[model samples]
Target: MATPPKPTKRRTYDAAFRAEALRLASESRSTQAAARALNINVKLLYKWQKAVQTPVAAALGASLDPTTAAELRQLRATNRRQAQELEILKKAIAIFSKTDEQ
Candidate 1:
């Protein structure tokens, strides 16, 4: 009787490895180009790129230092709020000016 072959286990990538793969793929002309240079699968590199932008990564902010990442989040939120407020003021001014002209 012939012996059965052992099943291969799935490969697990560390955070650093995933980050480097993303950086290389992004810096290149295209993911395909980068994958070719790195000798990794194009689809796998594409998956890593998408994974970095996911909410889970944003929640953890794994790429940057904790303090800097937190500050970035705060600044982005503040800028968004300010932008909305500016839009409202601009619309109000436009409306009031139109009324005055009429």
Candidate 2:
């Protein structure tokens, strides 16, 4: 019986290089042609394209969908505004307290 082949380890790519690969794959005449020109696997090019096109907040490392991400952004904005208002109210209370002691 033939021995089983060893599984290959996954490769890691940097953001800039991955972006370029995706762009080349998308803008090229064909994925096969782009892969050939880049000397990369055609399936790897497709994978890179999907990663680049995914709506992910990479900085936050969050992989939420676009609508969810937009909602989270709006919620954060609202939270910030509310926090500011609360701080102002606390300051006003302190001012009023000082006047009461006068």
Candidate 3:
């Protein structure tokens, strides 16, 4: 009986290279063309493209409007402030609880 061929191991790419590959994949070229240019697998490039493009898919071909950018920046700022406030509250509670135990 003939034995089946073994599958080849997948190559792992560094973060910087992966990011570049994704960038290339995001360009107007076809997946195969991008893969050829980037020296990566077409399937791998497609997967990375899908992962990175999920949120931006709707806006893929369009530029980001100023209002949208401003809203995103505000939301990120608010999130950071809330996180800082929560950390301070947690520290304050810990200090008070320790004082009460003494």
Best by TM-score: 1
Question: Candidate 3's residue-wise lDDT over 1-102, tens digit each?
Answer: 999999999788888898777656545357788899877778888777666543654464347665765476468669989999999999999999999999
Which scores better on lDDT, 1 or 3? Answer: 1
Query: Taking the tens digit of each residue's C-alpha lDDT, what string does model 1 give over 1-102?
Result: 998999999778788888778767756778899988877788988787776564855666557775775576578669989999999999999999999999
Predicted candidate 2 versus true structure: per-residue lDDT over 14-87, tens digit per residue = 88877677667656778899889978788888776556542545555546765875687578669989999999
Write down the lDDT that model 2 would get: 0.75
> Which order, best to worst by lDDT?
1, 2, 3
Whole-model lDDT for model 3 versus the true structure?
0.74
Candidate 3 wrong stretches, greater than 4 Å:
1-7, 55-102
RMSD of each: 14.7, 12.3, 6.2
Best by lDDT: 1
lDDT, model 1: 0.78
> What lDDT score belongs to each candidate, Candidate 1 first?
0.78, 0.75, 0.74
Error of 3 at 61 (Å): 9.0
Question: Against the hidden reference, what TM-scores do the models get?
Answer: 0.46, 0.41, 0.44
lDDT (0-100) at residue 61 of candidate 2? Answer: 55
User: Between which residue pairs do clashes occur in model 1?
Assistant: none
